[model samples]
Target: MYDVETRQRALALVAQGRSLNSVSKQTGISRAAIRSWQARPTPRLRRLAPCARCRPAPGAPDPADSYAYVLGLYLGDGCITRPPQHRTASLRITLDDAWPGVQQEAAAALRAVFPDNAIGWARKVGCHDLKVYSKHLTCLFPQHGPGKKHERPIALEAWQQTIVTAHPWEFIRGLIHSDGSRITNWTEKMSGGQRKRYEYPRYFFTNSSADIIALFTDALDRVGVEWKSAHQSRVARNISVSRKASVALMDLHVGPKH
Candidate 1:
């Protein structure tokens, strides 16, 4: 009799794209046990009776409960963007520019949602551009004001959609520039003859025009827009400027502003 909870965990790992071997290594269960669990149908236990090695301890936590907690964490804090990669970028929001009550309200809301979380502030040693970086429970939130210099705001949803619509060519060109760079070094000297050095290339551009085109096309398709490949090719090359083309592009770029 295999532990039902263990079987559920194995299934979850498989769903998360882990190889069977990786799952076995992670769970400390044999590959054969994983296979048997996978093969057995739900609501139908195997004919063979209790296997002593496979039995779970009394009061063991249910895998379903664990999975639900993990799902909640993901839904609450996980980034939905594809590839699950991180890029540091600058976010500039002045105390005056944004709504007056937004910051305090947002902070209070976050605390209410994540009771265990803490927030702190720190300043960089020599950097004049960056004023303070906020530390949340598990993530670093960088805040920028008038004087701070940070990465370009490439990931903001509004900016991303703008690049997809109004400035696709510039977006594609920026990606090309990112792909053609070489590695660089960063080193600094500390007090008392101690020095620290780290090798990290400056931000690399992703020459991802094809990716952008695919994304935009998929978005248009979902909205039932009748887009033509020839039009896209011409726009990519900066040659599509007929009146009809202009109207079509305008329609795509700015939908009914209701």
Candidate 2:
């Protein structure tokens, strides 16, 4: 059987008006499997408004700190969906269920962006999802596209560019909070014939999209922070910053997760 992700992608492709044959060829799944998924009953999105009238108003100013941070988070681990028969579209961000603070922050961001929208959360197996619905998500985060982000081109709008450039550190903090992590590193040292332990802190961000990585690196550069890639790979890029001074700066700005 095809995995859940595969089934979802196949259905999305078909929803976009692509033929079953094209989706089968692109995803390497059989037409029969794709057809089966299509035939299955589609589940109604829970915690969502019933109709377009229930959706929040769809206009918000651009280039604000909250706007930039939410955009960053969305770029990292979020998805937008608009069903053909549904009158409202939804924007969802999935976060680790263990991190309630992250979930709160995500909900706060959605509320900040769409003050009139009814924002809500739901539990998945290992994660919680934050959702908001409005036509404005596409306008605010134009980078949303079909298939996977790494397989498609992602470029910020001119207004978004202005916001990110103006608030690079907040943007980076949001990115790190989503796709990146901060951790303590330790090593054993021998000094004067005695074994000693040394500990330090570091941050690492991982993503499959080259453009997103570039955007991250550029933000770091703009903030005058030093970082390096853990390894060179096209499939997934890993970046880290561990210098004491740099970490100090990041800690002052981004702080730590509660």
Candidate 3:
């Protein structure tokens, strides 16, 4: 086992872009040994359970239960709207029609797709007659105009079915775009004191397109996706290159072969 001081020094050298071999030479540790140490998992802090008196007893009402209940409502027949401030409370009264059950089925499908997310639901009411909004409607035709006041009730069940049938890939592919957005979020700091963070290493992959393809291919393989690559035209317009000769190569024709 390496001492804490030695590990810290080795990590510092690695962070400074020092090669593993160079670090091993300076620290008198084998490169393989250093690599093994780096691979070891660090201890994590565990949260202690609250005292019996402070904790909610089994079967007792919990805040999470309320949220879950609201989620059920939303999943069933709830809607979103800007209610008037004067309204005391809005009750989501489902009509005797079969729409509520249909909505529930749709919600079940959505739950199957994203089992980890805690989707919530609620209905809105106000002094002014208003429109209702549902996730089902938005997920289907994302280009639909914004919710308007004095609109009739939307067919939540039909909308949800349309969404699932039309864009099954939308759920998964949307995550890729979201990952890029998350990276942007990490690189750009907010006005508040929150620290910018990244989920992956900045230099984990190489700069070349081929390297990127290799990295993604490896990732796809891990995910059990079959993929094939083919070379395409390298279209370049206004890109800055450090070397003029490298820029000239971009003008040359590259055959379509990968």
* Regions more than 4 Å wrong, model 2: 1-63, 232-234
Q: Write model 1 residue lDDT over 1-258, tens digit each, in one string.
A: 558777888878987989889999998888888876777545333343232223463221122222222212222122222122423222111222122232343234333333332422222342111111112211222112232112222122342343335444322222222121223546786757887665533212222244333443444444434444432342231111223443344344432111
> TM-score winner among the candidates?
2
As a TM-score, model 3 comes out at 0.19
Regions more than 4 Å wrong, model 3? 44-258
lDDT digits (tens) for residues 1-258 of candidate 3: 777678778867887999999999999989887776678523211223332223454222122222223232332233343347623222231322223443353344444433333333444342111122333333322222334211323232443333323332332122221111111112555547776654321111111233223333443344333434332335311111222332232222111111
Q: Which run of 10 residues does model 3 get worst, by summed lDDT?
A: 176-185
TM-score leaderboard ranking: 2, 3, 1
Regions of model 1 farther than 4 Å from truth = 1-88, 91-208, 231-258
Clashing pairs in 2: none
lDDT of each model, Cα atoms only? 0.35, 0.79, 0.35
Relative to the true structure, candidate 2 reaches a TM of 0.74
Model 2 residue 210 distance off true place after TM-score fit, in angstroms: 0.5
lDDT of 1: 0.35
